[model samples]
Target chain A: MDNLQTEIRQLIIDALDLEDMTAEDIDPAAPLFGDGLGLDSIDALELGVALRKRYQVRLDGDDPSVKRHFHSVNTLVELVRQHSERTA
Target chain B: MDALASGRPRLHRMTHEKPDGVTTRNTTLIESRGLTPPIAPGRMDSFSLPLAAWAAWPTHAPGCAAPTDSPPPPGAVDIAFVDPMLRRRLGPVARMALNVAHRCLGERTGVPMVFASRHGELARTLAMLHDLAAGEEVSPAAFSLSVHNAAAGVFSIARHDTAPATAIAAGDETLGMALVEARARLSEAHPQLLLVCADAPAPELYQDDITTTESAHALALLFDLHQSRRLHVARHASSGTPSNSMMSLPLADLLAGHRPDAAWSGTHARWEWTLDDA
Candidate 1:
């Protein structure tokens, strides 16, 4: 996994209080909602705020595109990378 | 016992060793003059909640009789039994309540629950408020868990309890009101229920204006109306007010064969609780 993907994995665990799991435990390609990691609406919103605070990765929860980026850790990394490139 | 049989009110002084080690004395006046007859048929304003089993965290009050069944589990509850998903989200205070709740209702499904906390999730709420004031977006997870009834909601989800659950916060008299609510709901439709009272002190900013428990603790009681020991609660409008009902201790102290007078007065009515021997 890329450093950014690993960082995103750790962010998800810390922001969601998944204390029992480590960053390595989360599969980058696994779905984060209903099945794979099993997060919910609240966790999604919290992650959005955490990313904005940490990496300045702005995300509008109501935007249809935001839903797609939250599908997996890989998608979140892509979203963060795109944002940083735009800012750079 | 003889003092109450006669029409005499007794004034007893109790010193509470706050978790911070500061001692505060509260003088509880047990006034039973000419009030014994009302209990013969049982007073309308008062109610009897028969308890089946009771458990509390950190059973170390000033006058608590040693627990008979076994010692209470430490501050952190046994999480081996809790779902990993739910266990992670439970704050320390929530864990305190859940630990005792699980103890009283172990493996017993569908039991109705009453969760009472005087300052429910105050710490979380205060943090969110600070974030908002700083022009920062608060964590949605914190907002969701800051509701007064969040403890009950989490417990129901963790246990998959389909039965009724009510969360209560009644200022200083939170425990009394919760017991009253439990009594009204206990009937043939629901013969028994669970009552869990938990509270931690308000954040330091509000602590000066708000009287709070020095430490975080929770108590759980399994109530069955038919039990031989009857809990008699009498409501009286007070002329002079009393201190906050050390919600964590007074009742638990009474049950531990320690004190007999755990009473508190709300605005209109004060509740006097007397646990009678079988």
Candidate 2:
């Protein structure tokens, strides 16, 4: 879980072009949008594409659960872990 | 010249005296290819370029050796004034344009802007086209910034400015036309206008069709109608040689005070620039 969290953090920084921030700067439990990371819809879409490409995880655009899943780095880690376990 | 009576516009007889006590009369007679007559004297307040910081640019000019070391990447562009998140989305050309425009405008805002480029965002456009051809989803950021006016639009957004902005693309005449537009805007309520011209080399697939010296470059010129320097543009017989890659190179030289006057031939006309003592 720790390794996956670090990887996801780095991925977010790189994929979103968060140039001034590092992986450690993003709090794992903090929100990823609105007031926390301040990412907007375009960034969300770009991040979704990047996450899909990297993890090969299934993501449905219309899934209401996606909003909850992307709430924080921890939630994203959990979602990815479950997806990987189910596929494995 | 009889060519003047061949149904072609004649060069208006005008003599301009340079600050250094040199007087020049442009005798090249041809049609007025673009905005003509009553060119109000305009002052160039400032200009900027990121590529000028390179130690030495790769040159194909005869008798000039290419640099031994690899050319430096585009110079440090300090756009700290802009929001970091928004800055991250800018490509090289857009970054260059914005950086120069900011430097030229300084603290001024709500002024009209004109952005000219021969091939605007060619790399981004090409990438989006390739993605489409490959049946892949095009990145929304790339698609939005790939438009010709994206630079100008981003400038307005960054400044939170409500002034009108125009984007122009006119082959080799891009800068000339942009100047004409800026000149026209000087008479409006806003006497000062910002003009930014930028271009990057076309992608390899289109390189054969496009010609430019540098891989990419951008220049911003702040023009005020009250200043003394003037630029006269008129159509000239097209030289048979293939056009150079960067149109702003000569203008850059003029702005840097290296030359009192400079002239360059474009696709359909000649541009003569001079600085005069008011």
Which candidate number would show the highest TM-score if scored against the true structure? Answer: 1
Q: Candidate 2 lDDT, tens digit per residue, B59-132?
A: 22211322122222434556677777788878777776787788778888777888898888888899989999
| Error of model 1, residue B276, in angstroms | 3.2
- Kindly give the number of clashing pairs for every candidate: 0, 2
Displacement of residue B64 (Cα, Å) in model 2 is 12
Worst 10-residue lDDT window, candidate 1 chain B: B18-27
Interface RMSD after interface superposition, model 2: 1.2
**True lDDT of residue A30, candidate 1:** 94
Give the per-residue Cα lDDT of candidate 1 at B3.
64
A1-88, model 1: which lDDT tens digit per residue?
3999889999999999997799999999999998999898888888988999999988776799988999999999999998888999
Off by over 4 Å in 2: A56-64, A85-88, B1-75, B237-245
Retained true contacts (fraction), each candidate: 0.89, 0.50
| Tens-digit lDDT track of model 2 for A1-88 | 8999999999999878788799999999999999998887878888788778888876787999999989999999998999899989
Q: What tier of docking accuracy does candidate 1 attain?
A: medium
